[model samples]
Target: MSFSPTGQAQVLVWAPEAEQVELILNEGNTSVPLKKEEFGYWSVTTDLVSPGDAYKFRLNDDQEFPDPVSLFQPNGVHGASQAYDETSFNWEDDNWQCPLLEDFVLYELHTGTFTPEGTFAGIEQKLDHLLELGVTAIEIMPVAQFPGDRNWGYDGVFPFAVQDSYGGPEGLQRMVSACHQKGMAVVLDIVYNHLGPEGNYLGAYGPYFTNKYNTPWGPAINFDDAWCDGVRRYFSENLLMWFRDFHVDAVRLDAVHAIKDFSPVHILREMKQQVNQLMETTGRTHYMIVELDLNDTCFINPLEEQGYGMDAQWVDEFHHALRVTMTGDQTGYYSDFTGISDLGKAYKDAYVYDGQFSPHRQKSFGVKAEGNPGKQFIVFTQNHDQVGNRMLGERLTELVSYEMQKLAAGAVILSPFLPMLWMGEEYAEPNRFQYFVSHTDPELAEAVRQGRKAEFGMFHAQGEAPDPMAEETFLQSKLQWDLLPLEPHQTLFRYYQTLLKLRKELPALKHLDRQNLEVVENDAHKTLQLRRWHDEEQVLCLMNFSNAPQTVALPLNAKTWNLVLDSAAPEWKGPQPSAPTANAGTEVLMQPESLLVFRGQS
Candidate 1:
């Protein structure tokens, strides 16, 4: 795993079943027999190898493959694994620190499609723009090494290696260095549930995968299986490597519900404990967020309370509610939600389906999320999953009118929970964020295409599902950055900038408390209002979801309310200004698909 001062490399490979293993180096011309050790590990110390040297293991003098925990795969996963000295990169973030979780306005973006360059350097080019947009953190999708130059990054096979196409390890470090310069935190998305089909050689190393449990990808990882101590160590070290070496402020674990581990202490809890230790050692604040569909509060709950102790979880019920209320399409899992009331519940509480009967799942789902802090629940209207998983990969802009789109932005930005805006949503990019993949293995590529197409049948979507392997699919999904400065896009972009400005400057908005936030819904007219307060300051966010103007009875506790911002104002090219001018217990009219922010005194 490391090298000695004499330029000798201590190469170790876990091959339990192999009787003989050889370390092959120098273009396969040199082979050194490794001494077998206790509990199935082969090791050898050779003075010939150094950092940046390409090497692989020969199992039983026949099978040869890259190292399972390779630090850098310069020649792709199928090629020899290269030794990388992580200390070689010069990082400039010595005094840098991440902002408080409550102060974070997250922006989730795919590194590849975020810019035309499709590299870490490309994303670094846009950091200033993100800082100006009031983004505290940029959550980059998985940049782990996958098969080819282009991928969504979920198919990453090498946990340690940064995508060779995305400017490798140094490139990622530079990107992080750039983010730190602007006081922005960097969060990386990592998949641990299952490995991708291509370039997955972990099974050759040890009992890394088990047939006892099955994942959507294939055999589940051997978390609780026989000879699983090594398996757990392998992945846990990967997590630490990111935090320690890559300087990642946070890690967004993808699909923890799919990770099946039956043990006294779950692997996620163990990872969380180790991360806390790392944070204490480094004297830095680190966050662990999860993308969970189970809707179980156990993921973010403290370890003493028998929880995984993750910092936050994505609550997509708000997105579902907003989508259903705006588009009125209740297909698939959207069947559980029914318009503004559901949206109101998600706003007041964290989740709409908290212990409620789900028609989509045909059972009661989710635990109560009320007691958790609002920041613990990350809410978003549009993200990679919500948009890219679609049959046609249409964004919210394609689903609703321009007015409703602004309302969607208002709902997310004004919500008590931590909110994340997907890439290009600020300027209303028109490109479809479709599911795309580039697998070198032709069979795997076709299989992915087939699986993605088959999934759309559950939703009963019309037209043919786009081919996920097609290069055109990925190219078409890239953001239309040029459109941001154009007509309506520029206006919407400014509207978002203004909303974020209010969120930062307003005390009531900034000092968010989830428990006491209130929601008033006028279901008859499809109008919803939220009353949130902190100390002596209070704010009201009112909106009409319907296509017709509605007169809503205001529940203003103060003598008078002043309109803070209006989506229906002519300044933003709306039909008319839907300004609420009334005292406590009076009524006010709201334009169709309009959201109005009001400030009032206690």
Candidate 2:
């Protein structure tokens, strides 16, 4: 869809099955016929409609529906689509360049709950908060048009339209420009596996979905089915639109594991090729980070290596292993992990389950990510899925002690891989990030509630899950920004700030070099030692996950180790009066559920 400044609008719709289509403008006041072109395409140009004018397409002159590729559904999803002039918004990021992928410290957030206003402008108001927290990048959950104002964003029906309640397309453009001006990149999460069941009219246009494969949500996207070219082109263009139009630095593809395609060149590889071409043509750096459960290196391997050339992938195994060690609640997928040993494996190798048989999966899972670099894996402790999918949507601090919360932070940040923090994690917000939605259909709402109940049957925990259809559930998920000045929350915030500073300034921590990293795990004491070096600078991380204090041997080298930042220090509210330092061949005692960082030099 394109709009002209002089009250002229033109649209190209792909409705293969329809014999005739009409363009309706001004709430059904004006109607114009569209000419049919090859490949089941329809086009019309008219001066009757202007920018921001509402429009819809009538199929077979029978029933009207919003454009399949609507750019802005100013009205709700059930309402008419609006003509948006993409060139109207002036972007001030012409001189801005995204930071390198390896140097990213991402903070994941939802636009609706990030601020009280629950809009794109709301997020822009809190830019200083993120900057003070030392976040180099902010990954926003999907803004695509969904059934209602509240959603996890996976239920988006329109891939191109920005949610109207969240300030529409112009509001998003402003936020991206604001972030670029603040020297921060934005990562937008998008779901391409399946469109939401409600307000989805893609089937009326063409074979956008196929029954050959099924995802957890429903039928898979028609990537490998008949007449799949249009379907593939539809999503590929959507990917390009975000980068070219909105200036998104990166896109976090949600659940790539659910997308089943049997084509020779997988859809991911194909999208990567297009993205590479776009980057080369525009001379800008952009990244594609995937949320994948299958620990396959083929997704992140170099294109020359006959693999998909994605920039990075979210390593859920790392979070699972880390959580199991901290909480020890072996339910659901947590049963497959063995606490500190798996965390050690995650440190050495990107994936904990590298071709190993799992009791949870009951089959061998994940190939070895041997040649992959540390930057290819994104590790996080409390993401939306990890928190909201729980029975009560409990944050890490809610389930563990204050020290264990600090330990979880250190585990992700001090690791060699890229680190991400969920929304409200830095200041230890007490609110639960529960699943909430406002579907207009009552039966659909009830179905979602039951689905959430069935999804958590394996946990066998007490109490019923919160109702997804409740307005209170959505209200309960909002971040309590006032907690920043509280007792333990302020201390935890400073601890994260110090760790982030060290990550940026320290030589050994700054560079991501997996080849020069070593991990030593002691199961008897539930401790792990990590040593990383770059050039002549070295850093050691000692982590104790046990309930009792334990002693860890330092590196037997000539370099003297100086204590940098210790979670067990009194400054961080630990029981210890002061942090301890050690020399080579000496041992240092680590407090229970604490982490210690040492900077070594000869």
Candidate 3:
């Protein structure tokens, strides 16, 4: 239950199976009986319950459970729920405004492992570094209340509550305020597909789950079942809470494909409508971005097109295609990608396998995004899922050479779609973002440890999986900030900074016209030619992913061009690559595993 501003609180719970229910407050010592209302709801209006008070609900005068819609479980999910005043924080973001989606250079990070402190305050301290890197916004991993501490946050149980270990509600408010103060927006990752297995008491309070559909996290939420109105109300309220209360600019909905709802107006559409209405009422910038495996553009398409009208969505296919091309490790789902063509297709057409058969799933995956804008797709080389899900959690830096890293960065930063950088990826962090969790249950912990070890067999990785329960496991995953000033690392950092600067200052690079972008792939020479234009200014990007040097003729818009950023330049500690000799006709010589960007004004 949520507490209000006038020092009074109303507690309401849906407990149809309980014979009697009571509200336990003031440290679970005082019990107050609640009156049962229609629709199987038990409620109580209490003046004694004030903010900072700890309470829980007693079912049948025997069992107790923390509030299902708790604002802050300061003592974890299993502990007593605390009454937190959402409007208590004195916000300082009155003049703050978010940049457009196309202008965002997103930096994604996990709170706990981002710094040694592993709290929201810790993240606030690192905002200066992001500002220096030319980042437009920060997209943080999930911060909802989960069991113990070290979860990756996909296993969040209480979607409304901030993780207590990460400094609770006030801490989160401080972080958001800090971001706005620095002219950077904050995007929060939230899960709606399923709640964590542990501390999930919504089913006990109401028909919050349906057994008709099964999900990886267990039974799907009752979005289209009996007593589903309350189910929908619960999530819609949670989505607005982050925007209205926490002041997060955007909400990144995780794994929308797993959310099963056969309703005429889908839950996603309903959420978009509510968020748009909120934007109309409150003159603040708010947007919704979802991560879905289905390559449907309806999520981000216009409402007149019978779409949900979302702002943007994550593109995993782009990352997969790029990874296969750069790393040449085509195991598992990466097997479906024939790097040369697939990478070019995803880069030019947004989706490589749109409505095409996938040999891996044995079914057609994704629909075409032909009409969607390029800015609606957010692309990244590495993320928490792609890296942490690994048994050893080895980042791309550990698997690939330094030149390929720069090539990938150029591809992401210079592309029309929004670019995102994982934590410490700019400086080539040496630490592995290993998967770690601190479940109090020994059986679950052991099972996770074994499962992680077995999953790496396909990758043929060496070594035993680190124990998730160990404190060292979490500590080992923390970013090494000292490595930023070291050799090769500092050069890459400068390269990323310069690329972002060019992206912001150059019109051709910033243009979001999906139709104007062109790609030329030559399997014979293992090279790619990208032509992007805005008005009369044009950018020619030549990429060489192969180990051998290659030369390609440029279909130049102008005979004269300026080399803006070359990945193989001596400044980046490469092989001191040189521009192609003018005597060799119009062909430009490229270094091995490097990308060269040229700008021309016609």
**Highest-lDDT candidate:** 2
Best-fitting candidate, scored by TM-score? 2
Clashing residue pairs for model 2: none
TM-score, one value per model:
0.97, 0.98, 0.97
Residues 1-602 of candidate 1 have per-residue lDDT tens digits of 56776667888777887889998889899998999998788898888788888988888889898988788887887999888767667889999988999888999999889999998999998888888788999999998889887788888888888888888888899999999988999999999998888999888777889999998788999999898877787889899988888899999999999999998999999999999999999998889999989888888999888889999988888889988988888988898888889999888778788887888998998888756888898988899999988899999888888999898899999988898999998988889999888888988888888888788866554677888888898899998888977989999988999899989988778877886588888778888889888877778888888999987766757777888899999877788987656677777778999998888864
The RMSD (Cα, Å) of candidate 3 is 1.7
Give the per-residue Cα lDDT of candidate 2 at 170: 96
Clashing pairs in 3: none
Q: What is the lDDT of residue 451 in candidate 1?
A: 87
RMSD of each: 1.7, 1.4, 1.7
lDDT tens readout by residue for model 3, 1-602: 65666667888887766779998877677999999888778888879788888888888878799988888898887899988888889999999988888888899999999998999999988999999999989999999999998988988999999999999999999999999999999999999999987788887787889998999878999899888888898899899999999999998999998999999888989988898889888889888999988888877887777888888999999999889888787888898887877889988888888998999889998788888888899999999989988778899899899999999998888887999999999999989998888887788778877877776666554777788888899999999988889988898899999999999888888888888788999876668888888888888888999999998876756666677878898889989774742321277789999998888755
Report the alpha-carbon TM-score of model 1 versus the true structure. 0.97
464: Cα error in model 3, Å: 1.5
lDDT of 1: 0.87
Model 1 weakest 10-residue run by lDDT: 453-462
TM-score of model 3 vs. true structure:
0.97
Winner on lDDT (1 vs 2): 2
The full ranking of all candidates by TM-score, starting with the best, is 2, 3, 1
Cα shift from native, residue 513, model 2 (Å)? 0.4
Worst 10 residues of 3 by lDDT: 576-585
